[model samples]
Target: MRDLEGRYVNCCSLRYGLSFFIHFCNIAIAAQRVCLSLTMVVMVNTTYSHELHNSSTNELLTNVKNPVYDWSPETQGLILSSIFYGAAIIQLPSGYLSGIYSIKKIVGCGLFLSSLCSLLIPLAAAFGKTSVIVCRVVQGIAQGMASTGQHEIWTKWAPPRERGRLTSICLSGFLLGSFIVLLVTGFICESLGWPIVFYIFSAYGGVLCLLWFVLVYDDPKDHPCISISEKQYITSSLVQQFSSSQQSLPIKSMLKSLPIWAISFATFGYFWSNTILFLYIPMYINSILHVNIKENGLLSALPFLFAWICGILSGQMADFFSSRSILSTTNIRKLFTTLGLLLPVLFSMCLLYLSSSYFSTVIFLILASATGAFSLPGMMINALDIAPRYYGFLKGVTILVGMIGGLISSTLTGIIINQDPESPWFEVFFLMTAVCLACLIFYLIFGEGEIQEWAKERKHTRL
Candidate 1:
């Protein structure tokens, strides 16, 4: 009787232990699903924000009847440029923040906070300049988290075989987000006025942030939703791109690298073209050149619409070259950078002369916009290819420098357009052209793909 009771108790204890283990596993799996989902949602919000402001060309000029906010050609340029100034200032800190902390947390916070800024903008404008610039600055600070965080996630999570395609997809969001933004903001501003833009973000972005908070974890070892197959797939492929080092990436070494500096410098020039087209074109059309507001929206939006084709082609081209073994990683990246940079220089130079002919202006703008895809190979992908571990820091450096480019372009253009609306705008294009050529020479000499080799050799000797 005693032996029988002891055996039964042992069996019951084993059953309870098994049940507890099963419950823990279920909770863990659910948590991972949440993380993966949130990871995706962050980009969705980014795309949404891009969409919200997309109506700049259409709504900004035409919607004004009484013109209370002072829509002079000069001020219009200032207003458009204001948002970018905010964006540039944030990029420096956001990039560096990722190196010190988790990318996921920073990005998650950014999405939610930017949404609030988006929500507040219309309210601020309603109140006056105190509100408007403050909200714009807030939006800029929120957005700063994106570029650095995105690069950090890419370096941490993405696999080499699929790296180009995945990157392209994320990169495509810049245009696609703008596309979606154009479609929504155009309709909303047409019906609701610009104030409603932030309202929409408040509702949408807040929900997405809530989802991210529950789901995302920083590292793969802890992530719950990832199946064993997926985990093995991600790790086996990605881990080798990094040499065997558990040490935190040395910032000094990365900052000093010539290739990294080349990409940074090159990006500085390219951003001038990007900002002029995306952020500043509306004023150029409506105030300086005297195009109607309705026509200006479609015209300003057209270049980005056209670039959609190029963005896709550029990504595919990047993958195609690598898969075929035609160019090493470095050369492939350089090819895109070289082409994207040079074409814009030419088109922008012509733009100064061609603004009189609307058709020629549009054509050059579209052609130039399409060439930006070329950088997909070099500046975009090289961060991952050359040093995945340190990409977070490098991305911060690049983002900081790029924002400075925007600041210079926007500030300079603001002064130029304000001074003499008729002719000096040509000088802005000319100055940018000279700068782009200087950047082209830079990439040719310094930004080789073999930079990782130099880094690895240094690491080995120290060991």
Candidate 2:
């Protein structure tokens, strides 16, 4: 009888595996914005390269069925910066709403809208620069909400012990998405044209939005197909870690917290460096190395691919150490965070000195990006450690600040590079190094892995 019961439970457990499948879907959703955003970068660079080479202006304009928009570098910067401007505006409100309302619907709708905007981008570009910026801004607003909603999902779904691995798996999609876009967009541009890149990625977003609605639920209790055993397992794990009722976010206290500031500032630094890599790497490859579009795509993708692998490996190592009690969570967080920031600084310095050697520069770029992936299990997951209940809100606040860094970096790169493409890249490399160093110092000083008093108080009061 006991054996029979065990078999029955095992069968039920298989039914519960549906939620595991949903994790992959979550990855797809996470990938959507990244793919769309970088696709634009690839498209713009390819179009600009085309314009530069084609000398028969009248014949080219007339013969080319779909003409690329001729925008100055400054205007291109504005278009790139516009997305982050909209993203920053929506981050806080979207987080708040996801916490209070249905995360599934909020995220689903956001992705759907963003997908629609992506589909319309080709049309917008045909109209003019302003039109393309408007489309990108709308997409950014939608993706901001979607991103916050994803963090909120983790609060409800991620088991405390498995948080590092699960969150890393989800976040790694960003790098994967970037890799795919950079690699594929180049070939797509060469074969089909830039417009097809937008259409293909938008279609992917549409499919993911549909899958999200079908497979995902806010909590275990709401999942129709989840077996009772799995539901009990999830509910039991979360109940121990989280408050049953939603409490008002201690905004004032959060703002006053040293650790929160550390996370935000560190995130700002990471974003500044990452934005430069993502938005400008294609241009760098084209302008400096004189690589063709296909080679440019493959080369640009290498760093992100390395980063994705490193992120997964670091996450597993973090979980192993935590499980074994080999290191305090605080120390682990600090160790990885330091490595992530410090190595990138060193790599950037190497780039400053060796920019002329294409092979050496590529190696440094890949190393810089890969080392930064250590932060996935470090500062990126630190919010759940300090405030699981408000992880979404905290992530939103940090990302809002980070987007400001992205905005400044993107615009500033345009201005500086426009002045002279061959200008000494040393200053830019030095600035990246300094930003990384400062953030590392601040995080090492103030970052914590312990839950804050405010979070503990809320849980205690509920008890």
* TM-score of every candidate relative to the true structure: 0.76, 0.85
Worst 10 residues of 1 by lDDT: 32-41
Q: Identify the leading candidate in terms of lDDT.
A: 2
What are the RMSD figures for all models against the true structure? Answer: 13.3, 5.0
Which residue pairs show collisions in model 2? none
lDDT tens per residue, model 2, 83-182: 7677788999997887788888998898898888878988898789999889888988987888666778777776665567767767777777777666
C-alpha lDDT score of every prediction, in listed order: 0.60, 0.74
Compare the candidates by TM-score and give the number of the best one.
2
Clashes of each: 11, 0
Query: What global local distance difference test value does model 1 have?
Result: 0.60
> Which tens-of-lDDT digit does each residue in 343-396 have in candidate 1?
877776677666577677778766766676567656766777777766666777
Scanning candidate 2 in windows of ten residues, the lowest lDDT window is 1-10
Model 2 regions more than 4 Å off: 1-65, 286-288, 354-357, 415-423, 457-463
